[model samples]
Target: MTNRSEAGWNFDNSYAWLPKTFYSSLNPTPVSKPKLIIFNEKLAESLGLNGRNLQSEEGTEIFAGNRLPDGAVPLAQAYAGHQFGHFAMLGDGRAILLGEQITPDGKRVDIQLKGSGRTPYSRGGDGRAALGPMLREYIISESMQALGIPTTRSLAVVTTGEDIIRETLLPGAVLTRTASSHLRVATFQYAANWGTDEDVRTLADYTINRHYPDIEENENRYLSLLEEVIKRQASLIAKWQLVGFIHGVMNTDNMAISGETIDYGPCAFMDTYDPATVFSSIDRQGRYAYGNQPYIGGWNLARFAETLLPLLHEDEKKAIGIAEDALAGYNEQFQSYWLAGMRAKLGLLNEEKEDETLIADLFKMMHAYQADYTNTFRALTFEDYEDTALFGSKEFTQWHEQWQARRGKQEKSNELSHQVMQSSNPAVIPRNHRVEEALKAAVEEGDFSVMEKLLQVLAKPFAHTPDQEEYCELPEPSKTPYRTFCGT
Candidate 1:
């Protein structure tokens, strides 16, 4: 076997230096057989890794957990989270953080092995992952990154020469995930609930250095960290809404403190514009519906703030006051971000008092007609004569006229406005049916051609490629009411 040390993984894991209770040290369980499925060439280059080596057999064994790279320190991080408002202690059940690799650009990023094996936190369940879910994360996370949203990235996928039992017997797989850091709000909650005040303070300081370095010198660094996290989440959720994404599970554990979209289980984008749309089968109450994401974000931030109350101030009453003030600003911050995104989607370069009403009116028309969310915005870039047929109704005609009048008030020319709208609205998304079709081919038929084509098309989501026009079409009626699962 080739030495992974020669593979150029410059591991420098700072998190491992923290208290032993923060995580459990362990190596990944060896798999029966290791086979490389996919390798992200571009991401590998960015990390200063040799692409050729990663595609070799040695890389397959390392990625599949049969071997460890030199300088690697594997551990399962400990955390506690509020899953759907109920707090519980949880940790890395099926994933192992190999270590942080310092890139050529001097950026430290975590490299994790998802579905490597059972850990101390497995909770009486097998820690193996099915091939379908591993591929699902690969497709969705890469799509999110291409859409210009902050998200955890998929580095590689390796097949295990064994079967895992899910709802039925399925092929096993492992995913190599890359991120700035895997720390979440639950990390703090875990420390607060189990460790002393010094432990919480230490974590806060470490997080501030890693994520919010600008606030490190501030007297109220803890409060500043809270606000910074809240702001990032506000902007992140706005991006999700603009793109019609439903996170399915917005649990506190799933919310990343870095503001990037992390877990992709049961997540989907809307084909039609419905504010109350939900895709996750487990989301029975619609608490995490499309329109409720902003609220859920605020709720999760509040939980994070609660963990920092001790560090916010020495006086309990004063600490509570500081946290409350920060929490109270979440809605206004969210609204500011959401409104700005809506303005861009509507092609309004200069905002006016009536912009909100104008945007709301268009959404109302779309809801009334059950319009395809993506297509409706994309069609606006075409000439009225060519696009009017897409929306044939007196109400739509009136709305169109009002929109034109509003556009006339802009300082920029009509062509420039159209350009802005085209950039803001994507011509295609990973439609639920298309994603399922690709997954089915890969899982049942061992055909990866469909998945490859879908990935290529999603890479340039804003462009309207002639050959990929069919991918932009909405799903048929038979595919309506689609429900996604967590794939556990």
Candidate 2:
């Protein structure tokens, strides 16, 4: 067995120093036959794990939770969340955060193991994961990062060589997930509900120091933290909308306080420009549809603010007023950010008063004609309308003329506007059908070339390439709509 020193794991876990009630220290349930499937060599190097020993059998054992590394402290964090609008206590069910890895850049990041094993928070369910969902997360999260979105990253996936029964028996796998921090809004909710005022205060200080350190010196650091969090979330959700990403589930627990995207379960991008689009098999009511994301962002922030009531003010009524007043700015902040992003996507360098109406009109036409969201923006970027059905409509023709006149008003030439649009809009997305195709090839046939191609293309989302053309094709129309499962 390879010793811990050779693996290059520079762990300095601060979360483990927290009160025992914050998390339960434990070891992963050992797997029988752990084997490496794929390891992220680039990410490993960034985390200072750039050693020759990582891709070997001993490294697979570390990722599979069959062996422990030096200074590794495994634990499952405790918290509560509102799932689908109902309050419930929850925690890490099938995941264990190994420790905080101090990277070469002097940054602390969580190195976690998903599908590690059962913890105290398992709640009657088997703590395991299927190979397909792990790969799906690996692909999608990396795609998000490439698109300049803040997100958790996947480091490796190792097969357990065991069965994980989800609707049926399937192969089990473990994913090594890295993130800035795993602290969620639900963590505050958990602290407020179960711990004392001192606990909430301590957590707030820790959060401010770790994430919003600029505000730590301010007298009203807690309120500043709230506002900063709201701002980051405003920008994050706008980016998601601009790209047509449907998070599918927006529970408070899934909302990362570090301003990075977490929990890629049941998430998918839009194939068609419909505000009512939902892809999660469990979302029967469409509570988390494409259009509802902005509102849900506000709702979740309000919940987070509520958790800060104890720290926001001494009196309850005063605290409620303060939270409401701060929340009042959320919609305006979101609108400003979204409108700015939309302007960039449309290649509008300078904002005009009519820009909002112009953008709305284009969306209306897109929805009316059922235009593909990503392709529509890409079409505008390249002025490519030969085979596009949206361009055939007279309404679109008039809108196109209006857009040209609007473009004519810009100070810069059309070349610069084209550049802006090209940079803002992606040439390819992880199309639903293509993702499924890759997943099936890897999981069922053990053919990884399909996924490799998809990952390579997704790693550079803006630049157009010949291989991107095949992935740009829409999914075949089917009687039943495409659906994604949590696969927990």
Candidate 3:
């Protein structure tokens, strides 16, 4: 075991310095046994941590909540969120933030332990996480980062050597998570409900200094914060759509104010293109479906904007007006980002009015043909269009002709255009079926090989490695209409 002092955790926790009412100061419950499963070496290096010490048994104990590192101040953050459009009081039921670490580059990032144990917010339930879900998040979050999407990252996974009761008894595990800050819209919601207006303003100011520091100089910094968050959500959702990714749950608490994809539960990438496709078993109404993500994103932003009304202006009516003006821009902003992203995916360097119609037509054709989303776009990069059979329709044939004509209008050469499309459209994604297989191997067979291989392929999503070509295949018919669980 390495000495605790040698672990080198440079803790500078700003959130802990906030009002005590904002969070509950508590150490993570020590588990009976702790075993290291995997450690993100690159992420460790980025945090200025020595990989050797972190991989040691003593480090596994720290990660598993069995021991606290030097200067660590563990706490569970308090928050309330709207679940399925209904407001509810909620908080960190099973997660603990082990303070923020100041990286070598002067960035402050939160180091948290999920599935650590119960907190004041546990609310009569066992505050523990299952092994499969922890691994699921580990796989998906890394894949999202590799795909160039801003997201919370997993640092390590540690088995707790205990059983947690969900649908059935499952192996317990703790996930070490890293993020700029875990503060969400629900954090503000909690402040508005439990604390005074002054508390809300304090949180807003703190958030600005942490996330949108550039806007701190503005007189209307809170309003500017709202606008910046809106822009990030808009761009983030656009990127999700382009990649056929669906965040099964877009609850207020799950939406990070840092503009990163925070929660990975029930999230899955589409196997076949369908605007109405939904992966979450809990999302029965399709509220967070592929097509509805943009709308839900806008809706979540509206909820966030409402929390900032107190800081927007003194007069309630004036504040409402200011928020409305900012909220109204979401649609236009989302459209702009979505349109530009779609154009890039199609390798259209020069924008024309017809580009929108062309993109819409392509989606309609994809829906009509039940084509695989990622592969369909990837196939366009081929000069000969060899995978025309994948589309299997005269409609796509006609659309291909139109796309060719549009390509001819681009300023760049065909080679450069192909490069642009290839860069935008990934040759691989963390496919739903493949992810399931990997999880099953890890949870059922105790085999990490499959999960490791999948991660390796996802690490280079844009590259079409010959050995990993099987990953590009769409799921078989039996796997269609796959349902994902929240894994809570």
Candidate 4:
């Protein structure tokens, strides 16, 4: 009922000052009632919010978009996207950005209310979110941050006390999320295709100033901006590969300009080391499988580069050439990052000419043996991989000898190699079954303890503590391959 000035929300409302076409100003359609489900205390404090003040009904309502804090200006952004490879005009259908907050570190970050309500781009869909999906985002996103991956974060999830009709009457909820900025590849795409050339230049300049400030004075700032984004995305995808995280839906719009992992929709960490592993129910073609992530990352970035052609050079041909030259290096850049990362995982201190072959052969064997990805790496790091069943086979026995021989050539001692491996591999991930178990408990049984414990375990992914042992083990095999829905 009252503004949350006491909650320490210092809103700057800068994005709202953009041209009207960039967004549409609106208030969230009020929910019947809002009940707080979870609050991220550490993130709240980091953003300079008074955590105690945000734990009340008033706080819950603020996230639910039923209450406004001081300096708040809610709007749904306008953008176009390539969804499953088809271009479409789209915008924020169920999410509302409530101004950028100036954090204690003096960083400007977007605070968005997802599942807030419908806007101009609702497209006849109910702009409400279900409780299960909201909680799923909270668990996975927070886990990503803990694992040192750049990502948008979930601050709170609040129940709307109303049913969101999907296949069934599921309870509605709202997720208060935060990110460096919500600028996506689709944002640039929209400006390029629909808005004037001036619009594209304006957005490119704004993005450089905000995300790549050092590049602001570069001779070719726009081209330099593209190069920086390409580098960032290359490294980010490499990290995702090392950890076996699959972003099931990677529509260009889902690709954030800040290079953070955005949208947790239908995403999952792989249980086994199969490159073809996929969990998204909608991604039947496997275009975005675990193994194809790097290629898809390149594909999405190419789409982004197209949006910047006008800003890259004056002559259309020269622009194409500049973009082509820049885009051409994506594979090399991605390979450089991925190779370096894989080397760390295998505890290889010094690179060898056959390093790529060594890693490729390992993956081939893993695919053949169905070895658990995270567990195998963790066991190797801890020196217990020899006890695993995968090592019982003759093929694995020979491979182990080769790996041992490779390690013998390392400049550092075995202890240092193991240390590097420990940091490179995670002892735990948000297992799909465990995540479902927590969601089922919270949404069906009204229990939060399961999720809370899982979060605690995930917070220290490399800790290797006894509490993480259970999570380190994979869930019992199910006859059906796991399927995840967008749950929008």
Q: All models: lDDT?
A: 0.88, 0.91, 0.90, 0.92
Candidate 2, residue 464: the lDDT equals 78
Candidate maximizing lDDT: 4
**Candidate 2: which pairs clash?**
none
**Which model is ahead, 1 or 2, in terms of lDDT?**
2
Number of clashing residue pairs, candidate 3: 0
Candidate 4 lDDT, 1-488, residue by residue in tens: 55748999899988887788899999988899899999999999999999899998778889888888778898999999899999999999999999999998999999999999999999888999999999999999999999899999999999999998999999999999999999999999999888999998888988998899999989999999999999999999999999999999999999999999999989999988898999999999998999999999999999999999988888999999999999899999999999999999999998899888888888888888888898888878887876454878888778888999999987799999999999989999999999999999999999999999999999999898888888877788799999999987
Q: For all candidates, what are the clash counts?
A: 0, 0, 0, 0
lDDT of 1 by residue, 1-488 (tens): 23556678898999999999899999999899888888889999999888898788888988999888778899999999998789998899999999999999999999999999999998876888888889999999999998899999999999999999987999999999999899998999999999989999999988988888999899899999999999999999989998999999999889898889998899999987999999999999999999999999988998899899999999999999999999899899889988988877778888788888888888888887788888888787554334323467887778778877888888998778878887888888899989999999998998989999999999999887796689977667873589998877
TM per prediction:
0.97, 0.98, 0.98, 0.99
Residue 346 local lDDT, model 3: 86
**If ranked by lDDT, best first, what sequence of candidates would result?**
4, 2, 3, 1
Model 3 weakest lDDT span, ten residues long: 383-392
Residues 1-488 of candidate 2 have per-residue lDDT tens digits of 32468778888988988888899999999898988888888889999995468887788889999887778899999999888899888999999999999998999999999999899999987999999999999999999999999999999998899998888899999999999999998998889888888888888898998888899888878889899999999989999999999999999999999889999999999988999999999999999999999999999999999989988889999989988988989999999999988988988999899998999999999999999999998888889986565978999999999999998999998899988898999999999999999999999999889998899999999987777887788888899988999988
Clashes of 1: 0
lDDT of 3 by residue, 1-488 (tens): 22466676899989999999999999899898889998899999999888899899889999999888788889999999899999988999999999999999999999999998899999887889999989999999999999899999999999999999999999999999999999999999999999999999999999999999999999899999999999999999988998999999999999999999998899999977898999899998999999999999999999998899999999999999999999899999999998888888888988898998998898887787677888888788764345544455778778888989988987789888778888888888999889999999999999999999999999999886786689987766783568889878
How does candidate 4 score on lDDT?
A: 0.92
Residue pairs clashing in model 4 are none
Better of 1 and 4 by lDDT: 4
